[model samples]
Target: MKKNMGNADRIIRVIIAAIIAALYYTNVITGTLGIVLLVLAGVFVLTSLISFCPLYAPFGIKTCPMKKG
Candidate 1:
């Protein structure tokens, strides 16, 4: 898939995911809410790594800089 996420977007997602993981591990967030957040964090990391967002594709949202080509 074409990269729909820019460097800033990827970095932000990673940072947010890290924060969620830390909160979950520390018990600041627990139970069902924590589990849901943890899953979302995993998705964030995955999308960041690939620089693609499935949701963005359907919406035609692209944060990456346009190619000059």
Candidate 2:
């Protein structure tokens, strides 16, 4: 799929994911809430790595800058 996420978007997602992980690891978040957030963080990292967000596709959202002709 075409990249719908820009560098900044990807970076921000990664940062958020890292923060979640840190919280989980530090026991600041635990139990079901922690598990759910960890899973979401994993998804964020996956999407950031691929530079694509499936949810954004349906909304026609594109964070990536347009290519200059």
Candidate 3:
């Protein structure tokens, strides 16, 4: 798959995932909602690392800049 995420997008996702993880670990978030967020956080990290978002593919959205020929 092509990279559809730019540096800013990747950074933001990583930050969000880190926040979610911190909240869960600190007990600031708990139960079902915490679990759900934790899972979403994992997805965020995965997508950021891979630089691709499956959801964005169908919509034709791309945050990555075009390469010069």
TM-scores of the candidates are 0.98, 0.98, 0.97
Q: What lDDT tens digits, residue by residue, belong to model 1 across residues 1-69?
A: 999999999999999999999999999999999999999999999999999999999999999999998
lDDT of 3 by residue, 1-69 (tens): 999999999999999999999999999999999999999999999999999999999999999999999
> Please, what are the lDDT tens digits per residue for candidate 2 over residues 1-69?
999999999999999999999999999999999999999999999999999999999999999999999
lDDT of 1: 0.99
**Candidate 3 TM-score over all chains jointly:** 0.97
Ten-residue region with minimum lDDT total, candidate 2: 2-11
Candidate 1 regions exceeding 4 Å error are: none
* Model 3 bad stretches (over 4 Å): none
